[model samples]
Target chain A: MSFKVRQEIATCGGKLLKLSHFSELIGLSMDVNVYLPKQYYSKDYEKVIPTVYYLSGLTCSPDNASEKAFWQFQADKYGFGMVFPDTSPRGDSVPDDPEKSWDFGIAASFYVNATKKPYDKHYMMYDYIHKELPVLLDEHFSESSTKKLDFLDNVGITGHSMGGYGALTGFLKNYDANRYKSCSAFAPIVNPSSVPWGQKAFKGYLSDDENDWDKYDPCKLIKRITNTRNDMILIHQGTKDPFLKDNLKTDLLTEASKNTSWEGKIDIRYADGYDHSYFFVSTFVPDHARFHAKNLGLI
Target chain B: MSFKVRQEIATCGGKLLKLSHFSELIGLSMDVNVYLPKQYYSKDYEKVIPTVYYLSGLTCSPDNASEKAFWQFQADKYGFGMVFPDTSPRGDSVPDDPEKSWDFGIAASFYVNATKKPYDKHYMMYDYIHKELPVLLDEHFSESSTKKLDFLDNVGITGHSMGGYGALTGFLKNYDANRYKSCSAFAPIVNPSSVPWGQKAFKGYLSDDENDWDKYDPCKLIKRITNTRNDMILIHQGTKDPFLKDNLKTDLLTEASKNTSWEGKIDIRYADGYDHSYFFVSTFVPDHARFHAKNLGLI
Candidate 1:
């Protein structure tokens, strides 16, 4: 088995499998936590469980969402599994932020394939997350069994903050191919190319060229990609989020969606008196879970 | 207000208020997190909100349970507030274990009033949790207002591991006074007098004498206290808990209850494949919440 079991913890009605495997894409041993719902162990159950990939925000690892997001209950309730992937590749060999800041390097990959020197060697989060990870998970999990889990085909994607931006970018970039059956975000950095957090990451990972950024910018991707399936993207932004006014201008995505096929389908919700913490992510997780469940044909 | 608001975070249709205040009993400042449910903000609702006091395990602050317990949803659903108290009195002034072990010093108070040496002056968690904290909370929250919350009465007590022992000790010691309307625990140290973790704390905080330890031990308290109201104490023990074979030994509590008035009233449910972490506590929080809600008349 390529994936090593770090720990198998029983939570809610299922087990949380903390797995780590060497990713050829990111060139590091990537950690991921998968919550297999109660149905997986039920003798009477027959359906192959679909999965929801939850990407965490800055300074986060796979354990953060696994511990705090409270998604295991929702996954069990809907009879779906949850996959929590690490924010970025890490090790002593990997290059870090030159200034040692949180927003540019290490735990802040921006889920982009880096093109710059130093970072380009190991910071291949985009390809790791969207390409290698899912297929590998399916092969490792299903190849040995009766296809109890489907990680490649019937999948949904969602994230928080930087991860939200990742979800949007990956979803929009692969909209035509329908890589993600459902997509949503919580307090995501929508217009990363315009924001400082995104600009720093884009400039550090990619070059100063705007062309490199336009390839992954959700705002630009939203305008170019046509919604062939009439699928809607769910979003929840807290009014009291510390980053709302500055980094996460969620309204910018709404504006970018204007006059495009994705316009009016990007459902943006404003949660009053909430912050950009796990408290907010966990609170709205039910809504996002249900939305994904319906889209992934779980409901 | 004598209590300072450290932070007020919105979580799951409620606000988690992090408060810190000087504790005259313990002679140190203590931190606590209180979650005021959604019912508190409703103009249409008039019932005074009862509270559940959740004592955390060793080496945990109020923030651990406040963030990981996933109780705010249950509190909002059951129309009850939640109180997350610090495990022990902190700051450099407070005495720590001579060995600086996590099970006996700093974060680990064993929720008992110490009677020996430097520990006696500060390790007054028993009085701090059951007596002073509750009365002080009521005085601070309801002294001037229309009494929206009841901290002194109509309360439930619950905890995990070391804190579970705290809950049981607090509940049984005050059983005659009818202090808490409900009590429950998640993988609690049932017989602290015998367990190594509990014995270490007892020796450090109390004394070498077994008599002093008997006062705080649940096994002794269960036999001494009579359940006049026939109140049941709910407990969830994990079969796969690493501490089960040694420190916890939850079945001992059941054995101790054999001939006493509390016999069969201590309902212990063993969860399969669970562990000694917050993952286990959070998984069964719903069950404990329901049990407390029913006993506290929230159902």
Candidate 2:
């Protein structure tokens, strides 16, 4: 339940704290980064700061978004804090891809609770990220600081690629419970069950039964969930992304919401000439921040 | 004389064109990245876009600042163009550091023309960056597009660490000729002739004559150059930078300016808890951009 501060980095009008903590769910050490906006350090600030959770893509750590996403400036602008969670559980004993490919294993947990052998031991990332991490963060911040930083409620969720799928799935799965107030993604694999990257991860982590895959698929989850609040899910996809045709079928998610309660509520923007990199993600971050800020009532 | 478009990346509200060209000065193929602001692509923008040349530090290609600096947003906000020049001339024919050290050869040219053997053949970065590159860029852009992108007179210069030293040296040395309109630096080595990193670069690139080193040292140049335009050189130094004490002594430049015409004109801001990495550089980019925009009459 205790976190070790690895490094405190001074960024744009904020401090990025890199922390590592032992997770009981996964039984391993996990790394996360938190960016405290300038408002957090100001003596005159009195209001509680809301949070935005950003999950990273394949082969990425918390450091990737912390360094390149350019989110600190926006967090400071909107008076909100940011949380960057690692992509997957990592350790020497953790099971990795037998082929040692980048799209699966150590850095790619697909944000699912594994029921399969070998992966079941430490790859409980879905539970670790959405469930345990938030409670731990709330307890830690409450014990350490006089300022109130919300980690449970008044939170927004967003991610890139695989994490995008995770965010969509999480937001949809917990829609009735009101888990996240806002959700967005950058070049996300919407229908992962159909994509090669998603299929591989699902097969490796979930089970042989195809029905189990629908539990985490954003396309399928959108059909079952009811959007009572008229909430909008913002998404940005690059037209020049190499994985657009093969892995990220952005149109499928929109197609899935054709007649459901989620119809006309998902905003999928196609950006021209942008690639599936931080260059593209950081560019559209300001828009996403504003979207989340509006939904979180920070604007 | 011609540049090859390696990649044109869409970032922020503009495009980053990665270009490679054959330089007559260095006699080697050089790579440079030009970021055209959104104004260039807009129909209403009629004024020539001012340019800001950013020189990267040791062991860095043009890609480092292009990907990490987060300068594109500022460029779009202020309607200014950005130029990122490579640190050194690289090829198999070009000589490298005898010790294979990062601080001496290859990516550490120190932006000085070499007068020594071997290095003298291709290490002509001083002329290449300040003189030849600008003319070539002007000619290239003039032929390629209708949008007037200024790379010559209406320009500012900035860099980090060794390149920070380069920016200062180039601005000060060419002050009389009015080469650059504004100048700023991030954690630059002020007194390069005295510091270990600078000493190594100067020794490897220049001749044995100690007088040759004085020609490029910013501390020495500041004392000799007269500040007539009431112009201020903006500089940001991190207090927690690992190389602050050993390599980057920010006070030396201030001390050198004492009793000289340039006294009280050097704005060296010491940022607390920041390091020598791009994190520190990107954090203060907005301030520097505004400073240059004001100096270049863009504000």
Candidate 3:
């Protein structure tokens, strides 16, 4: 459960600690970046810092969101920490896509527990992220600092694109337990089981069966899970995003929520002229931060 | 004098226009990115917008600073435009370092007009940046928009690393004429003539002669140029920056300014434990933005 500190960088009234630790669930070493906001360093700060887990999109590392998301400024303002987990497990031993494609291999885990051969050995990200990482983080941070951090229960979850889908699925799957207090996404693939990128990943990592794919899909999870707390899911999708029409059909999420307990609880804001890059993500990060801050009871 | 817009990305309450145009002095196509603030699009706004030119460091295109500087947010906040100019001319015909070292060739023009053989053909960045590019930008932006932009006259200058040296040299040399209304730097190489990076660039671009090198060195320029307006140059240097010991000795500028009119006017703030990366630059960008905003009469 102990993490090795790689680089602790001073940035934006806080420190970004780049850490590497062995994952007992995935059976691989993983890198994660945790930003401890300015309040964390304050001696008088008595409250346990609640974290927002930010998952990155395909073909990304922890560094992408840590560098470009521009979340530190907002985190400092709201007194919240941020966790940026790697998109997938990576190493020479780790099996990659046979086609050498970016979407289904090393940096494209899709946050799924693989049921297929070769991939089943290392692609247990779904279990690692939700079940194990948070508990391990809660323990490590508590032992490391006098001021505690609530990574397990009092946390929020958000991501971009594929990670966005992961966030929605995770938040909905654990909705009954209230694992995450807040949920949001930036250009997420809401209904992953129907999309080409998701289909390919599912076939490669799981199986060809739609029944197996439906288990991890956000659209299916929305109908299965009952929202008892009258919670909201915040999302921002850019109109000019190239992947909007094909892979990320944001409207399908609203359609899936209709006649269900989650109907009208999805706040999806379509930003005009914005694309699916970090530029778009950073622009609306302030808004998302406010949403998460409110749910986490910071504001 | 005309610019071709390669890409216009909507980022934070503004549009980042990646433009390309032929430089008359350098005799090559140069890339520059201009960020137009949200105020520019306002229909009823009457005031002419002022620009702040941000020169990038070595081994970087116009896109590096445009993507990472986080200047768009500040530009939108202050209602001022930002111009990110390339460091050097590029192409197959352009002469690079014989050894292909990243510091003294291709992207390392030192923002100086080369006086040597093949480099002289294309490495005329000094004249292009401080003299030609601004006028061309003024002409192009004025013709394109209903609300004019003051790119040439009422503009500020700033940069990082090698470009930091560029900012200091340009601001001091043009102080008498007040070419740049404001100036600032992040981890700048102050005494370029004394440093190894500056020595190699000066020898390669200018000549072996110390007198030629002195003309472009900020240490020398401060003594030569009189600070008649009692203007101050704000500079931020990271204490943990790797180059601080050698290439970027921030105190040398202060040492050179003593007994001169520039004494006590070079406000260099040494920030603790910040590195020479965009992380450090972006952290201090808010401070620099406020400084430029006030100087440009935007605040």
Any idea how many clashes model 3 has?
0
lDDT (C-alpha) at residue A158 in model 3: 99
Chain A TM-scores, per candidate, are: 0.98, 0.99, 0.99
Candidate 1 regions with alpha-carbon error over 4 angstroms: B144-147
lDDT of 1 by residue, B14-87 (tens): 89999999899988889999999999878888998999999999899999998898999999999999999999
What does candidate 2's lDDT look like per residue over A34-55, in tens digits? 9999999989999999999999
Docking class of 3: high
Q: Write the per-residue lDDT of candidate 2 for residues B32-136, one digit (tens) a residue.
A: 999999999999999999999999999999999998898899999999999999999998998999889999889999999999988999999999999999999
iRMSD (1 decimal) for each model: 0.6, 1.0, 0.7
Candidate 2, chain B, TM-score (2 decimals): 0.99
CA lDDT of every candidate: 0.91, 0.93, 0.92
Q: Order the candidates by lDDT, highest first — what do you get?
A: 2, 3, 1
TM-score of 2: 0.98
Candidate 3 docks with a DockQ of 0.82
Please give the TM-score for the first chain of candidate 3: 0.99
Candidate 2, pairs of clashing residues: none
Top model number, lDDT? 2
lDDT of 3 by residue, B52-143 (tens): 98989999899888878899999888889999999999999899999999998899999999999889999999999999999899889778
Weakest lDDT window of 10 consecutive positions for candidate 1 chain B: B139-148
